[model samples]
Target: MEVLINLTLNGLATGMLIFLLAAGLTLIFGLMDVLNFAHGGLFAWGAYSGTWIYTSTGSFFAGIAGAILTGLILGLATEKWIIKPVYGNHIQQILITLGLMLVLSEMLKVVWGPNQISASPPSYLAGSWELGNIIIIKYRVFIIAVGLMVFALVQYVLKSTKIGLVVRAGVMDKEMVQSLGINIQKIFMMVFMVGAAMAALGGVLLAPYSGVIYAEMGLEFAILAFIVVVIGGMGSFPGSILAAVLVGLSGSFMAYYVPSLSLAVNMLLMSAVLIFRPQGLFGLKG
Candidate 1:
């Protein structure tokens, strides 16, 4: 029973983190059809920047705010200079963004040096809670709460607002949206910024959870985010959340019961999904 609870908690926490990362990726891809290999760079930047701020100010909240701000600024710059020129060109987007990814990773070395940095949850979130023989980590709970809030906020905005309507419509038919006198370029830029911010949020939250962070961590998790995006459906925000949770739970159970299959499990799942539903579980068919 205790083991079950622990695994559940672990899976949910991990899922939330992945959801935070993949949510942005899927949205961007769905809307813009541009594959951004450099998205992970934003994540690494968040972790490093957030950690530095937390260390300097002795406040976790400030650290998160700083990280998000960094992501927003970088996102704007990336959209304008790097991504803009390559719009509507998948080949160029892939090549340039892949190069950008390497640059971002290498830049991290220049800025933070070659050492992995240690991170810890703030004092208030450092402990665990016990309830009838089950122990729950406070930081995990906090992460889960933040993830849900973010998801809800995104959902609400997408479902209840005019901007969201335009974004959703644009995903279906970019030409139609533009024909309707909408400046879709502005919407694209906004979505990119939000996605970048979410990726950064995932990075900052992951720092304390993992207990240490390094430059290449972004690439590592970016693979997982890609998987989640594929499995969740290209443009389905809710699908990303559900897929992330599934991936998280599968990993948790497999790691404990079949250690050798832990790494292969997610791949196997993705393959099955691809074979069975190429459009993804929640993706709309054209």
Candidate 2:
């Protein structure tokens, strides 16, 4: 039972990290209708930059803050320069984003060097707590806390704030929202920046969790993030959280009890959902 609980906690932590990444990916797709392959590039940049800050300052919190800022800046640049021109054209968007992805990725290697860097949890998060027969890792707990916080905050913003309402409305019908005297383009920039920050934050958090950061790691995880986004339903924040948790848990348990099937687990889950409901588990249909 204790082992089961430990695995569950681990899975939840992993899910939360993925949730951070997928949340931004979904929101970008949902509101902007831009398929951004460069999202992963932002993720890699976050890990590299955050790790550098953390190492230099010897402060994990500072690392996280710096990483988020890096994401915001990159997001702004990409939106203004690369993505702006490609809007409304799927082929152009795809080509440009893919190109941007390559450019950003190479820039990571140039700036950070082409080597994997190791990351460790902060001192306060380095140990484990024992509860009767169970052991809970502090970093995992911290991740879960942060993830839930992000979820709650986003939910509140979406349900209660004017900006949130606009985003939600835009998701449903962007043209209709634009017709109502709103600057949809400005909103797109804000949403894109926020999403980029989230992805960068995810990368920073994941760096220590995985113990090593590398340029190529972003693409590997991006694949999983994309799967989670598709499974959860495009444009549904709640759906992304739920689907991420499910994928995280499945991956965790499968790795322990069914190693060979671990890689196939997510694909199978996605396949099942697609076969039954092509729009995805929570995606709003067009």
Candidate 3:
């Protein structure tokens, strides 16, 4: 029972991390209809920048803020300079973003050196709690809490706020939103920036969880983020979280019970979902 609980906690923690990354990707793809393969680059930058700031200043929150700021700047630059030209062209978006991904990775190596950087949780978050025979890691719990809060906050913004109404309406009929004297382009930029910030937040949090951050890590996790987006359905926020949790749990359990298939399990799950429900578990059919 303790083992099960531990695994569940681990899975939830992992899922939350992935959700942070996927949430933004889904929003960008859904609202902007752009395939942003370079989103992972933003994630990597967050981890690198945040870890640096954390280590230098001995303040974890400062690191997070720095990372978020980095993401917002990068997001704006990418959207305005690179993505704006390639809008409505998936092929160009794919090619250009992929190139950007490589550029971002190389820039990380140049700025941070070629070695992987180690990250540790702050003193307050470094310990574990004991409950009878069951032990729970504080850092893991912290991650879960943060993830849930972010989800709730974003959900409220999307569902209750006027901007959220505009975003949703734009997704359904961008032409109509534009026709109503609203600057849909500005909305797109805002969404993209928010998405990038979320990805950066995920990256910073993941640094301590994984114990190290590397330049190539972005590409690897980006693949998983894409997988989660696909499994949950493109442009579906609720679907992204649900799918992220499913993937996280499955990976955690599979790693313990079926080590050989741990990596392959995600692909299998995605395939099964695709075969049965092409639109994804929570995605609407186009």
Candidate 4:
């Protein structure tokens, strides 16, 4: 029972991390119709920058704020200089973003040097809680709480706010939204920025969880995020969280029970989902 509880908490923490990255990808693809292969680069940058800030200031919250700000700035630049020109062209988007991804990764090496940096949770969050037969890691609980809060806040904005309505309407029929003089371009930029910020947030949080930050880490996790996005549904916000949790739990259990198949399990899950439901578990059919 203790083992199960531990694994459950571990899986939940991992799922939250994947959700942060996948959430941004889904939103960008769903609303903007742009495939951003470079999204993971942003994640890596956040990890590196946030870790640096945390180490320098000895304040984890400040590091998170810095990472988010970095994401916002980078998102604006990418949209304006790199992504904007290739809108509506999947092949171009793929090629350009892939190139950008490489550039971002290389830039990380240049800035942080080609080495893994260690990260630790703040002093207040560095320990574990004991409860009779069960032990809960403080950092893991903190991560879960943050993830839930982010999900709730975003859901509220998407479901109940004027901007959310506009964003949703734009997703359904952007042409109509544009006809309504809504300046869909500006909306697109805002969505991209928010998505990037989410990805950065994920990266920063992951740094302390994994205890190391490396440039290639972005690409490594980006693959998982993509898998989660596919399993959850292309544009379904709720679906992303569900899929992330499923993936996280599967990985946690598999790693314990069948260590050799731990990595293959994700691919198997993705394949099964593709065969059974090409549109994804919650994706709308055209």
lDDT of each: 0.91, 0.92, 0.93, 0.92
TM-score per candidate, chains pooled: 0.98, 0.98, 0.98, 0.98
The alpha-carbon lDDT assigned to residue 68 of candidate 3 equals: 95
What's each prediction's clash count? 0, 0, 0, 0
Candidate 4 matches the true fold with a TM-score of 0.98
Model 4 regions lying over 4 Å from their true place: none
What digit string (tens of lDDT, one per residue) describes model 3 on residues 61-134? 99999999999999999999999998898899999999999999999999999998999999999989999989
Worst 10 residues of 1 by lDDT: 277-286
In model 4, the number of clashes is 0
Question: How big is the positional error of residue 138 in model 4, measured in Å on the Cα after superposition?
Answer: 0.4
Candidate 4 structure quality by residue, lDDT tens digits, 162-250: 99999888767889999998988999999999999999999999999999999999899899999999999888889999999999889
Clashing pairs in 3: none
Q: Judged by lDDT, which candidate is best?
A: 3
Candidate 3 deviant stretches above 4 angstroms: none
Model 1 residue 167 CA deviation in Å: 0.8
lDDT of 3 at 10: 97
